[model samples]
Target: MKGAPRMPQDDADAPRFARRVGILVTGIVAVSFWIVTLLGALAVVTRFVRTIVVPRAKRTEPVRVRDVDLARGEIEFDADGDSRTPGRYSFWFDDDEGHARVGDITGGGAVTVTRRIIGVDFGDLRGVSRGRLGSWFHLAPGEFGHPYSDVTIETERGPAPAWLIPAAEPTDRWVVMVHGWGGRRPECLRAVETFHRAGYTCLIVSYRNDGEAPDSADGRYGLGDTEWRDVESALLFAGEHGAGGVVLAGWSMGGAISLQTVLRSGHAASVTGIVLDSPAVDWHDILAFQGTLNRLPEPITRTVVRTLGNGWGRTISGLATPIDFARLDVLGQADRLRVPIHILHSRDDGFVPHNGSARLAALRPDIVSYDEWGVARHARLWNYDSDRWDRSVSGWLTGLEG
Candidate 1:
């Protein structure tokens, strides 16, 4: 008779208890200072790697340029939409800044044709204050339908997606293009086009939480963790389709995924070269840089970082907050790679900074060829001055194979 259980006194009390406990823990963690920061860093890194395997949208053959004589034939179109070109053609531009049909020569002769330009705007982030990162990620899929016609590859997380443009001549060399955060497969067409012109089959890939692959298994982005699989799958698909050699190229965070894939794909002997455009080397450092650029309070930024580490991170990542910068610790893993690396970055990349390209170039000097330009925005050096930037990077890459 004395073994009776006590009934709930008040449901309201339970809420109060949880709230009070939460406040106390927060205060404790805040007082502990560096403990939370360290934990946050770990959490961010863990979720980032987890994102390496998100699903992607399938892309079929999309119309893109294949060749340029470099002398008599000029790709006459402006890339940035400045409308400075005197008498070039008009083309559509798809970039981070916004979507707009641009006048020829606005992009400084980056494009030779005015039919359909595959680029974006954001060079002048002067007073822009809107949109989430997911908005950018979904932009491409929404704009252009999936553009590939090849066998679909599956990721541990889900099926890796891409826009495949098979070479007309079938050079047996495949170039896989990976986009940065807030970007989809076609976003890299401007860069991948150069590869295609050089006689290589091209594959512009889209990762989960990006483009049409927004709802893969993880249902959250892990930075390059799950995204890296998309690149890896592209390489394998290229190999199976008769690619004698493989080229992995990435922009921004996409560069980190490319690095990780190159290091991990020891099984793919065909992957002979790597190309990084303004890639970050360390996630920790990148967050600080972005934080400074965005003017976020140090305390709040660090706190959010710690919370990321405390949880499974899926919930945090699926949140798709802007605080989720790139994690590029892949340099440590680069030690396992046996291919040549080609890096290009501008000293004036106000956003990504130039240290990343420098460090990556140094990671494998024996097999790496590094180049740095001046005053060019992220991935826009070519658009600013096509004659100069394009010639430099394109010539270097071509010379390597010759």
Candidate 2:
């Protein structure tokens, strides 16, 4: 090796080779890092999708009942955001065996709050330790003084339970009410009396994957995609039962389902108007807002949305059919809406953002009557101010009649 006198070229080649190796090693490490990051993001997105599609079987009771003074018409609860929030709320205890209405925070401390108990609908509240607070103040239509009959609407999945409350004065107009995500027929009972007073028969329906309705094949929520079909069946039932004109009233995700029903159903011609409360106008918007609320990274939210929209993601999302987000976007297709829409959304909605509703109202003011509220939480506008809710809805119904 020493036979050749040290050449300049040979020394130059040594550094060049070292540089190539360095570049190659750095490239490999960067690629590996990206791969690991992608895998972690995918894992997070999978869990998020599961929660969105999977139906929850049990309701969580986070409000603890510290004491119940029935004689004094008062109830004390361990103070929390929901328990301390103003306005009336329903308390369900012992697997929903007991239900009571609590109104107005009478007194409050750092760790406890006592509310005036309006009345106990059922079950003894004496020894109840804990319960769930909700907006379902009325358990059934009868609670609001309307006689209702249990009827079944035959859907593609099976018979779905519904509450049929006929109008006191005979009228062919019907208002088919749909509840929000994970809600039952009782959630729609608050709006029944108003519709009944306006001479509209109220039909509160339960769609598939909701506890009251028959389960779909996948036992998952379609997030208004497939659930709309069940609502279509309800519309057909209403049409068969002499519904001359129909109004579709929905809350939260139910609004999404109602939007889809009107756009996709053959029976859409029968729908003369729509009423929405705290609606999920766009699933993409809702999911993005939720992702941000949960502190998820932006890329993770985008990837989750892409996965939900692609066929290859079915394995991860557990969806039988890849969701078509473009089709579910009501804002994108506002021009297609023919019926009058009355949207009542609260600025303080914690669950679903009201911006989409505001945008929709701005876009289609001709057909949309947006009644914006200041303090009502999601789907609880009636609970917050029943007089205003009734006036708005009744006025809207009167406009439709005129």
Candidate 3:
């Protein structure tokens, strides 16, 4: 049989068959790999976009108060479109800058419910009354007994609006306050009360991408990478405006900005101290902590973190340049810090983990005075217990000022 002349069709068919089989196997493997890689890449990109590029709506629209039952200490209201009242909340009228009322929603129904109100009202409601606990409660610099004047801080971008609340007794030492991510300048009003009372002038500032301030190129958060420059500009403004020494009081991401400014700014020597509340010291640590809470795989988060700082990832994430995650790592660079830093962190912080701050404190106990609180989430240590939070922060300021 081997000696017989082989037919042309038979010889051609054998080679052709082998070729087709090999191609099929190769195609299948390549396609499978491509699909898996695409999916993983998508996951990484989505997380990066959500954290860095996407703008989270700052504060929810206020719920309307339908009726107030003074006799029963309950107020009825219609919650329309994401106005669900969960846990304890504060209520204030349209004209009332004083958020002097706290209450809880006791009755839950379809659309309208009743809440138990504590404290007195702001006289009588006239116009549209809006109720919010976290945000609107903080007055815009001048309300609630603290006198404030509207001022502008000149930045590289443009003039950024701010609130300048001078202390009763003028001191060259000023408290330059920075708010958290998506937080307005008024968010510093809580800290303003404590610092103002302690005879320190407060300059609550607004940075880029704050909606009111000049928008960034992509309108994305720099995660303290670029935002720190705005903070440095504020320091320059303070120096020009008769500030001898400055105490930086920052919350959440603001704390990161403060740290970066101190490390990067030439005027760092003028910074007497820093106060960080639930600060995002290390972004990688915080992202991983949140990833654990969301039950995302470690590999995906690792990839996301890697890509966040990678140039290729920057292109994919719509960023002009790669994020400097190393710069955001205060814990890693704790030894470089020269000024005294006071950190107030909560063990139960959901957004930014307390471990990062704790590690920073442990790394430089001589420079850092860390105060840990329980049962409070990120940036709400003061809201949980106002008196205690104020006293502790005031005491730290006193030590630094003295």
Candidate 4:
């Protein structure tokens, strides 16, 4: 009876039972691990969605600083009169003043504020830490709208413009040259000499910060803000000095401003042609380049730019001359151009890409003629191959005249 009761199933059965227990334990451990990992992932995603993604979108807004067009000093009316202080633009007002064509004030800063005025600023404006205090724009000497230009224009604060007319019979055809940041009229001398010999009268202009001109506001450089107006004034001077038609030629940032002056939509009837060398199309894009060159990306670039760049116009140039990247800006309108344009750039330009000129030609085949050479960085193509440069530009202009 004892022997019958004690019958073990088998050694094989014992081993099989152990194997089943091991499989169950392994399955449980795997399931537990996966569940823990899923919870961790959800936590990370929630933080990302809430902290980084949601706040940026929610806080973003389009800037809207109202422009209050004041009457010219001769007028005594309240139509656009502002008495914030003497000449400085006021930034205290918050409401959008409908469409009153007021003096332009661009705004932005590191702190939270409803409005900010950039180009020119008075201490009266609220929500602004500081604003630029200087001339809004510069005026050049030239006669505009006249059959020819042969006069001098005195800037608002400066002496009469110096016109270094070539020592020859005054020529009706003109090439008005504008230079870039830290550059003076002398910077365009190389190109000017060729044009001078080609029988084209050349006039080099001085902007707010060039050739004895006063310092810019905020002590910083604007790629093109107030400088564009200087070019406009210069164009008018050219017309007065007996220039039958105007040829605007600029280098680097000056090139960009020259284009803006000519392409100023509602008024481009006077300009005969345009020449830009290594011009930047979008300033914001340039800043992006600055970031990349420094190896900063995404949120860091966005943050630093948002923080320091907000006050850039106000602090850096010592002139709060805010440059609106919008505003019928020339770079935006490669098409819709009815006039002739010749762009010169280099493949090795360090500051601006040759592709900008290329893009312009691609956009407006009829108006734009692009030249991206292989040597001489930035606007120095002429120095690299002076003969070629002179021939290309001088020939193009002569052909146009004929």
Candidate 5:
């Protein structure tokens, strides 16, 4: 009694059951794969967001000082991309107790490059073994033959320190100089002489979380979304100090902040012009360029950008408020610009790509004067060629006066 005669139904049920089980197993594997992929993407997004919002710790010493020849007025440093770059730069050592300016590369070997010492502002370079290189070649306003007073701008976050360098002649025309991300007021000192000669009082300002300024509630960078507010306070300070007309000069992230202030500030009517050096006009473009430079996947970049703009990403980015990237897009809102803009961007800008500035200039050629340069790194246009930089700025300011 072999159970019963061979039943077609039973045979069919066996195959059907096997097929159903196979389908279930495949579904589980596919779900698991997607879940893993999603988790990985989330991790990438979180890290990218943190990088944008978090303030990096100040580097104690990034460049190794190989030697310093006082008689030759030259300094030797371990050769790297920044040290080898053709331009003048500053070095701070002993926790900024020592400062020195180094100029055009004189010579180099396999691992070290020697540069002419422009001057040692305060520190004796002889005993220094390591230091940090910077683009702020001029350490103070006095270096440019102008007396400066340390002032404070009362910002929403708190009082932020600023350098108020009066013009050689009594004048109501003023220029508020904003340094880039992770930059200090000293970086703006390089442009003080040019603006001062043009009879514009220079106010070099520090914004929130820039180390010198008070930290924000979250202590995170807004990528210009929130930093612009601090700059607005600087504009108000200028107006109170008898600024009949003002020009906003900014570098790198400072450029982005200046743009936002022009668009959002109540005192914008007082602003006559804007000067942007290696400006990050579009955050999206900047972030995308940065991602590419760091070899991040396109998907990760897109997700990180999305995270920065939405509510859900606030926790991940440590942002008190979700950034409205659309508002930060100067190119998209070019028509709203009321003041003339002079953009000095280098074709070889390694940090902020020049395409955004180029597009903006092309779109608004009538109001935007683009002075494209060659071989200048980001925010170091003046360091590369001070004469050219000064001439361009002076000429532009003259036109603004007219």
Candidate 6:
């Protein structure tokens, strides 16, 4: 029978075919798993660079100025959305001497007007150029003519530049100010006025990888992991100067750095108080919120955190060794804060979550004073309502005095 027709043996053929099918399925699954793992690793690397790298300046928006009606004291320009977008904006441009001139925004539409142009010093705006006016909402200290000295503080890396503005009423208490991620020293100008008025010298600081400051070996941010040391150097500088004690004030990521400096730096005894504006109290929460905003699922955030926190995982994610994301959890260690802390956070903050701030305040009610605002996003508490911000900080200072 075998030689003549090879009569089908169903039992023998079926097992071999089934074994082949099983092998195919197993190979498919193994390939799929590797592909997914590679993709996840790539995603982690991309997020690492974007989150920690200091972004370069983009070329200025192609002169959006359409027209300038000198007679009516108005200018026409394009905005991100409707020019009528409700918020404060300032008209800015370089004058003949290349000094920045800014004027208050009177109204916004297709056409907008500016008032009290700086440098020109003309009411209703005069000596204004028909060229592009780089409008900004955040005001810099240069516009106010507040005298400040450019000083450098020595850090482990190198010298980092800072702006030292002495208070008119001059007290021994120094206020060291740190700006947020991608923010410059000018961002502290709003808080500077309040601190100066309270008789505190203000030191607007620049840390590693901040362009003006010396670049880190990796040229990537530690998210307050290593930047805290630069802040410690600034604190030492203040102590060497006329500062009897210091009040550390920070905005956004700056707040994270400030918190780390307080907790880790040996200079904790010198820092009497801390003021955080929309701070990233817990990096874990912030990353999770960011994942939500960017439409990434919880698993991706968890993977990212794990990748950033460990050595081998960081290598896969294209990060240098030693990130220390665990230490960025300031809220987790709220009880460790010995000095009084004042936190100003916005419920509408699009970046860092307010829950961490609230939790920290609740956990250490005896040492932490929480002030909530809903007017603006991220580190824009002052821009939304400067009067209220000033009053709050001033009140805290008064409380410290008492």
Model number with the top TM-score: 2
Segments of candidate 4 deviating more than 4 angstroms: 1-152, 216-219, 265-267, 300-321
Ranking by lDDT: 2, 5, 3, 6, 1, 4
Worst 10 residues of 6 by lDDT: 93-102
Report lDDT (Cα) of residue 337, candidate 5.
Answer: 94
What would the TM-scores of all predictions be? 0.62, 0.88, 0.80, 0.57, 0.88, 0.79
Which residue pairs clash within candidate 3? Answer: none
**TM-score-better candidate, 1 vs 4:** 1
Q: What global local distance difference test value does model 4 have?
A: 0.55
Candidate 6, residue 223: CA error in Å? 0.9
Distance (Å) between predicted and true CA of 136, model 3? Answer: 5.8
Candidate 5, backbone clash total = 0
Candidate 5: where is the Cα deviation over 4 Å? 1-40, 60-66, 94-97, 109-111, 122-130
Q: How close is candidate 4 to the true structure, as a TM-score?
A: 0.57
Better of 1 and 5 by TM-score: 5
TM-score of 2: 0.88
lDDT of each: 0.58, 0.90, 0.77, 0.55, 0.89, 0.74
Give one digit per residue, the lDDT tens place, for model 1 in 1-402: 253333337996677667766787887788788787777765655444343323333322122323322233233322332223232121222233343222233223454333233333334322222211111212232233323464456655567666677765758878878888656665576564467567777777776677555355546555565567667767777777788888888887788788777655544566777777777566655666666665656764564455444444445444343223433365556576678778888787766778766876787788778888875566555455556645665786797688
In model 6, what are the clashing residue pairs, if there are any? none
Please provide, for model 5 over 232-350, each residue's C-alpha lDDT reduced to its tens digit, 9 standing for 90 to 100: 99989998989999899999999999999999998899999999999999788889998999889998899898888998988799888888988998889999998999999998898
Regions of model 3 farther than 4 Å from truth: 1-37, 40-44, 57-101, 104-115, 118-136
| Per-residue lDDT over 222-265 for candidate 2, one digit per residue giving the tens place of the 0 to 100 score | 87889999999999999999999999999999999999999889
State the RMSD for candidate 4.
19.8
lDDT of 6 by residue, 240-353 (tens): 998999999998889999999999999878999999999978888888888888887677777777767777665554456557876777766777889999999988787788
Candidate 5, 345: how far from true, in Å? 0.5
**Which residue ranges in model 6 land beyond 4 Å of their true spot?**
1-37, 53-140, 316-318
